[model samples]
Each structure stands twice: as structure tokens, then as C-alpha cells.
Target: MSNPGEIAAVIRAVLEALPVDALRAANTAAGESAERIAAATEGTGHDAPREALAHIAEGIERTGEALAGLGEIRERLNAYLAVLVPGVEAMVARPIAGPAGKRPITPPNRRHHLNSVGRKSQVREENTVILPGTDVRGDLDAIRRGEAAWLPDRDRCLVNGRLYGVEVPGTVYPDEGPGLVKLNRSEYKALKGLIEARGDMDSLPSALANNPAVTGADWQRAAEVYEHHKDYRSEDT
Candidate 1:
């Protein structure tokens, strides 16, 4: 005899046990593609194409929402199944042991290094040329000074904390021209002093403005480190 409740439980268990990393990644890509197309077409005479792309982005968003909804449904089913069956979660989560008596053919690091396919697949430098315009250095300097951020926004990196013209030439885009990349030294003294004094992020604005070399990117990276090591401060208080 077959049971609908039992069938639902199996499905729920499978949903809970499976990873959604790839699905979430694909959805994020689709959304970004839509954003790029929209940004590229803004103020141009391409309303129809832009509208279509916007629709496609909406569809991708809906699909992601549906996947999240499915996860919620799985939770409900698991609750129902828990009442129907005992130790079901444990049974579903049981680990499968690797094959016994199988000795290593190569050391892990050596095997990874010797992966010929991986080596060939690595991205090789195609070309490099200087990206002119005093703006680029200015932006990086601002970022170093905590006055600018280079965080991701769709297909573009927000330049100098500018709210508009996000897709213009010389702005940070993944593709197209920007020519050669020059590494700029980050000034971390001001932010470093604040950290040494055990100051939180609340009072960083004035300190950052004073230090032109210590940029916004430096502040962001510092914030992440502080978050991870915050317990050290907590222990003192």
C-alpha cells in the first residue's frame, strides 16, 4: 500500500538534505545580467529591449523566491513527517562512509598541483594597457581614504561613492576597457589608530576624512576583521 503522507515526507527530506548553492548562484547571475542590460540601455532609444530584459530579471527573481518557498514547504512537511515517523531526520542525515581499504594514490596537495586540466583552465592574462583619466587614481585614493567604496553593484563597482552614472566609461565594470591595472598602496594608519584604541565603527567618519591614504575599501576590510575578532573587545568589557 502506498501513502501520500509518506511520499511527501521523502520529498521533504530530499529537499532539506540537498544543497542549493548552485541554484542560488545561477539566479544571482541571471539577476545581474538583467541589471547590466538595463544599465547599458538607460536613456538610449532601446526601451523595448530593456523592458524585455527587465521582465526576464523579474522572472529570475520569481524563480528564486519559489525555490525559497519550496524550502519553507519542506519544513512544514518535515514537521508533519516527524509526527508520522520517529528519528526520521537522523535517518535522512546519516553519513555514508567512504570505500574501505582504498589507499591514497597521491598526496592531496601534489594531486591538486598535478591536475593538468585545472592548470589549463586557469585564466591567463590576455592583455594590459593603461586606463587614462585622472579619475581612476582619484577614486582609488578616495577608497584608500575611507571616502570611497568599490563594492559590487550589479555589473559595476560603485566609483567614489557616486550614486549616478554607474556604468560610464572608466568606471569599474567586469568587461570592456579599463586597460592596465595599477596597484595603489593602502594607507591604514588612521583606521589602525582607531582599532588600537578599541574604537567601534560608530566614530570612523571623521577619522577617515582626515586620512586621505586610508580609503573606504580599507575601512570595509577592517570592519570585517573587527567583526570576526569582536569577542576580544567583548571580553575586556
Candidate 2:
């Protein structure tokens, strides 16, 4: 017999225990390395240096995406705890502590990185190409300056003369939309393992039996994982 209260406590502990700061530090180190590589290879015409820089850039982007996903999980987990374990949300809301005696690095603005994907170079100076006649121009300017946030109700709009889209706050995908289930990395691996064992995602169960990694995960999570896995394969292939 499992207690929901106890389970919630365990979840809170694990979330707090995550080494988010360490991951950020590593990502910062990689970004610095990339900068050096880019500077050194400016006109050398060397393939190796450019290749290395590309790999570093891809890694930095992936790490940023993973951090964004973890943040979403933390927020949702806190909301879940608020209902089952009362007051835990407030306690967990405090920023997680980092390594002792180390000054935390300020993370770069991720708004462009999140949407750029392979289009990293397009993340140029903010407002460098504003659309002259769009209704959302004011909104875009505010968002770019960090003075305001994009409204959840807002959809595709022009920013800097380019069409852009926003992921609505708290928007949960319906097995075919953007991946937003609360499953962590290990649980995601477990779900992938199950799919492989079954030889296809169509045969996977809604939930993993007897697996604590996915105690609170459900069908939507399984579907999203399968979709994302396939998408990754297709894009890489």
C-alpha cells in the first residue's frame, strides 16, 4: 500500500535534489568553449574546428531544451504537491541551492534559442527587423525588452518582421501536439524501452506496470514520448 502524502514528499525531495545548477554550469562552460572555437576559426578554413564548434552549438541547444523541460516538470510537480501535501509548494518554490562558494552564472536569454532550433544564427539582435504594420508589434516589443510576457491567448504574430508563434501557457498536448508530459529522463527511457520491447509504439500500454519511475504518468505521456522519439529519429535520419 502506497500513501499519496508520502509519495508527494518523495517527489518534492527528488525535485529539490536535482543538480540543475551543475547542469547550467556545464552548459555555460560549453558556451564559452564554443565562443573560443568560433573566434579561433574565423578565417582558418579548417573543417575540424568548424565541425567541433557545430557539435558544441548543438549540445548547448539540447541542454537548454532539457532544462526548459525540467522547469516545466518542476512547476507542474509543485502544483500537484500543493493539492496532496499542502505548503510543500511554498517550500519548494525557493530557488534550489548551487555549489558552495561558486558564483552562479546568469543564463542567456532562451526565448530565441527555444524557437531557433537549427536556425540558431537567426537569433540576432532583438528588434533588428520589426514589422511596421502588425497589431502585435507593441506586444512583441514589450516581450523582447522583458518588460512583458506573451499572452497565452495570442497565437501566430509578427516579431521583427518575421512570423512567430507562442506555446500557450499550461497547454497540454493531445498525444499529437507539443511534448509536455511530466515524465523525467529515466522514465522517458523506460517508456522507450517498453516501446522497443513491444517492437512498436502502437502496442505499448498506457502505463508501465510496477514501475515507480512513472507512478504518476499516464497515457498522454506515453503517446507524447512515442511521438517525440519518432520525430527525433526522423529528423536525425
Candidate 3:
């Protein structure tokens, strides 16, 4: 047992030598920092959920941009079609007229098909000629005399193995077909009866109108018949 004054002095010296005050101040600062950290964490919440929301907003904006681009492209295509439609309609509105019963002339690219059919055989073998009607008897006699004339009114004629050409009743080229054949006596009589009934020699001929002569007739004899007939012969002849 020491004196009370001396004991108190020793205890004070021990407390000063130790770091107790420094430790207390450090603990108080640590508690304040922890509380600040807790408040900051509560205020902001989880970073992951906010990041997910930001990504969703960005994706929606990109999708909207893509849809707008598509709409612009569609508008451009519609404008192109609107300009093109009227020109196409105008072309369709106008059409070219061709011959009534004849084939459209062969195009250049497909003309090779005609080579096998039109063999360029003898004119007699390729009897593709169609002679003038009886109204033009003088023209027929001139052809028999070895003259080549372009007779527009009739199918072209083959005279002395030569083609006398025409346009309306087109001249058949050597490769086209065999020429006309002779009409039998009975066929000739029937043809004459048709012509007599119509009495319009310049109009469609008996063969073309409605007669057996249409298939194949002796156009040479047919011409002669029209020439001799007083009712059918031209006034000039």
C-alpha cells in the first residue's frame, strides 16, 4: 500500500505513455466513414439493375432507327413504280395490225426454221404462186408470155418457172410451198357456178369466199375462165 498522491501520479504517467486517446479518435472516424458508405450505397442501390435498364433503352432506340430506314427505302421504291406505270400503259394502248390470214413474217433470229420448209426446190416443185383473179386477164396473158409483173391484187404467180411478186397477196418464196395445182373438170364447173351466182368478180373470189377451189385450184385456167366470160371480164379488156 502506497500513498494515494503517489498512486494517482503513477496511473496518470501510464495513461500518457499508452496510445488510448489516439485509438478512440481513430474508432470514431471509422464509424463515421462506415455510416457515410452505408448511406451512399442505399441512395444509389444496385449498379447491375440500372445497367440493364440502360441497355434496354439503347436497344429500343436502335430498333426504331432500323424501322425508319426501312420505311425510307419503301418510299423510294413506290416513287419509282409511279413514274414507270404510265409509259407501259401508253405502249400497250397502241398495237400494230397484221395481215388477216397470213403468218407474221419470221423474225431474223428464228429465220433458220424457214430453211427446212422452203427448200429452194424447182419453181414447179415449190408451186407457191397464187395468180391474179379473172378481172386481170391481160396481166395473166402477159405472164404466160414470160413477163414478170408485180400483181398486188392476187397471190404471186409463177410464170415460166419465174416468180411474179406481189405484196397484199404475198409472193411465196421458193422455200415456202409447192405452187398451185390444176382444178379437175368438176371442180372447175363448181367454181364457175359460184362466180356466176355472186356476179361480183372484184369481190372475194369463188375459191376464197366459200368453194372447194379454195384449197388448191388451177389459177391459170381460172384466170382464162374469168377473161372469156362476158359477165366477168373487165370493161378495159
Give candidate 2 regions above 4 Å deviation.
91-237
Question: 1-237 in candidate 1: lDDT tens per residue?
Answer: 268666756766576655444444455456456556767888898669767875765665455455455455556766766766655663232121111012211111211111111212222232111222324445333222222212235332222222111322223322222322222223233324445445555555565546676678756644443333332265456
Between prediction 2 and prediction 3, the one with superior TM-score is 2
**How high is the CA lDDT of each candidate model?**
0.40, 0.43, 0.35
By TM-score, rank the candidates, best first: 2, 1, 3
In angstroms, how far off is 103's CA in candidate 2?
A: 16
Candidate 1 steric clashes: 9
Candidate 3 residue lDDT tens string, 1-237: 456545544443443443323322332333334334544666577875445544533443343334334344444534443454423221111111112114322211211121111223222212222223221233233332222222233334322223233335432232121232234544354344435443354565435456553344544455544443434546575
In model 1, pairs of residues that clash are 129-180, 143-215, 143-216, 144-214, 144-215, 145-214, 145-215, 146-215, 146-216
Residue pairs of candidate 3 with colliding backbone atoms: 118-175, 127-178, 127-179, 128-179, 130-155
Worst 10 residues of 1 by lDDT: 96-105
User: For this target, which candidate reaches the highest lDDT against the unseen true structure?
Assistant: 2
How far does residue 115 in candidate 1 sit from its true spot (Å)? 57
| Candidate with the larger lDDT of 2 and 3 | 2
Best-to-worst ranking by lDDT: 2, 1, 3
